[model samples]
Target: MTAAVESEAPAEVLPGLYDIDAELYHSDPIPGGSLSSSGARKLATECPAKFKYWSEHPQPVKKEFELGTAAHTLILGDGPELVVVDAEKWTTNAVKAEVAAIRAEGKTPLKPSDLKRVTEMVAALRADPDAAPFLEPGSGVAEQSAFWEDHGIWRRARFDWLRHDGQLVDYKTTKSANPSDLPKVIHDWGYHQQQEYYLDAGLALDLVDPEKPFQFVLQEKEPPYLVVVTTCDPVARGIGRHLNDRALNTFALCRASGEWPGYLEAPLTALPAWVERQYA
Candidate 1:
């Protein structure tokens, strides 16, 4: 009997430097993906000023240092094998606990519009049969981070799971029912931005040189919604450069002016808009 030759296509990939719309970062989908909506809202309200305070001052050694280090240690540990298990375990349990304590009492939890947005994601994933492949098989989470510099601005992003080749990846649970519809949805949401920002940060860190490439792993939540991967071309990071400046500037002004009360008193919606107007 003759053995049939098996041919396989190369995996999809992405470049290492770029920018992403903030929405993608906020739209993660897992059991409690939308769970944080209430907490984020409370922060916007009860301790409105705290946002500025938190943004301006460097994070305390306990949080920024201890947790981050712990996360890395867990990532490098052997038992979990996949780094994301460590990350999800850390994020869902530890991060949630810390936020709960620091959050004020008597400040009723507020519902952000993102709840509806994420629910929409869950529904779509359930409708699509192909999305199953994209769902994290309750495994395969890896830890990664990137550092970057642009026009004197500096930034860093730490994440979980990347392709074996060091290609940047952001996992997702989608809302599409049809398998074929996934690509269009991913493109429309500026899904490319997630990997781009990481790549840009990685470039700044000098982790990879020119021709640096990466990938974005899309894990769907629906049946038939198996994994979808995409590779992209490197592009100039114009908006990312600006946003980094804005975040840094917002932090600096809060510190230098000593006028932090306005942030706390203002409407929740106003903070982002004001930050943009000031930095833009």
Candidate 2:
């Protein structure tokens, strides 16, 4: 069940699926505030002070992210329209002004060459037998936002793709999509926690089945644009769930007390075991 965003803001943000714009969703217009997967991850991995600060002040878009965003627009057939700038370099004042204006209108501006690369990357992704079926244009909805309550906290998640056949798919652009390197990538970026959090949203709203594992479609940014399809195993999912719970509780406490604390001060720390073993 999907609800369309009204031209005027609703008095209350009811829990359900929504077909809303990315800008509005990120703005977090949910009444009494809401916790997103990214926010939960930040609170769990870093200090709450960092999360609080960043949440209040959204970061500016980075140039590195433009390629991935363009690819998503092409592949998922959703998101902000990409405006191709016909220029070899953006050093010129005119080119920079055009790019800025395009962004001001909520459109993504890409170099002609970058747009061509993104098109090729999408082609490579479509050719993958394992990944191709999941992203078939009419097979699912793209960029759908889900909102629901969990343990007295309003939780929200935006899915990259939700298949009609009950699968949750997330697309990621990376420097390397090699399966061997993915474990560390997943650990460092908290992909496991992200998966569990997304899954939790779907499960709460009955959009996903418990038996179905969350799917990740990872693609490399460079030449060949290799794509890999994978999912979190039970152990990883367990760890993710535990961490999410901890973050949620921490967020609740901080909100109630109006205190977002930083890391422990002046604490004694030991060197990593691997470093100690090398010295020994």
Candidate 3:
């Protein structure tokens, strides 16, 4: 006899709020979207109008963004994830139809060149001792999406892979994969904040190991497709937490007051700090 299964009650996420649901996450329309790590970063730095525009307007994934995503899909996903076409024969009517069909079916379309580069990058990743295990069999969760409350606000993070050993690995495509220049890159991209934020979600939901850290596999976009494994230093992660706090506070204030301001009224009378420091 089969044992009867008991169904558990659904989670108590608030109305108009949905925690991470991976199947529906990518398909949904973006205009008027909820806050996420990327949004938080942009809100913290960008002019309010730009931030508001991002929040209020529908955002189609940019071509570059799609390419990066396709790379990730190819590297990590098990099933057929995308529809790629040969760039050389891409102008043909049948190829055009295939491309349009991919769009119609809501799948990502890629050129042959893009796939080639991704394959090269994948090879680079597999050759690296650190990143190879990250993509190994039973390498833990792939493309897991999560949502949790941050400062009473709903925020989401879509993790590329969260390993059993407590390491969260995210693939990044960059113009340069030089370890020497990564600090500036990390700071500029708010990637450290992403580490904190993603960890926050994972820890809160008991989804990932709390002790281990995040590891980023940085791959170059060009010919060689060099790969490097790196992590945010503790000090940087601390700074990232602070940055996230500031962003959260700013967002809360703006939402409560419904005022999204633009750039400063103070006009620039002289060159900025970097220029002055250089001349000093």
Q: What global local distance difference test value does model 1 have?
A: 0.38
**Position 110, candidate 1: lDDT:** 16
Q: What is the Cα root-mean-square deviation between model 3 and the actual structure?
A: 5.2
Model 1 scores a TM of 0.38
Off by over 4 Å in 1: 1-50, 53-141, 146-154, 162-166, 177-193, 231-237, 258-280
lDDT of 1 by residue, 1-280 (tens): 1111112211222212222321232232112111121222223243437654443353323432222233222322211111112122335676565444543221111123322333444444344454323333333334433333344333445444433333344544445524477556644554444445555555554543345355444544434434555554334234333433444555345445655454334444455677889888
Question: Which model, 1 or 3, shows the larger TM-score?
Answer: 3
- Counting clashing residue pairs in each candidate, in order, gives 36, 0, 0
Highest TM-score model number? 2
lDDT of each: 0.38, 0.88, 0.71
Residue 269 of model 3, lDDT score? 81
TM-score of 2: 0.93
Per-residue lDDT over 1-280 for candidate 2, one digit per residue giving the tens place of the 0 to 100 score:
3323234334576778887788888899788789999998988888999999989998867878989999999999998899989997999999999999998888989988998899999999999999898898988889888888877889899999988877899999998899999998898889999999998888888887667678999999998999999998889889999999999999999999999998888678889999999999
* C-alpha RMSD of candidate 1: 15.7
Q: Residue-wise lDDT of candidate 3 within 1-280, one digit each (tens)?
A: 1111112212454222133444455433233334677777887778767887876675665667767777777777732267777665678888889887876665788887777777887777778887788767576657655656655676766677767666677888887879889998898898999988888777766666666677888888776778888889989999999888887887777777888888878765888889999989
Question: Ten consecutive residues with minimal summed lDDT in candidate 1?
Answer: 1-10
- Once model 2 is optimally superposed onto the true structure by TM-score, how far is the C-alpha of residue 117 displaced, in angstroms? 0.7
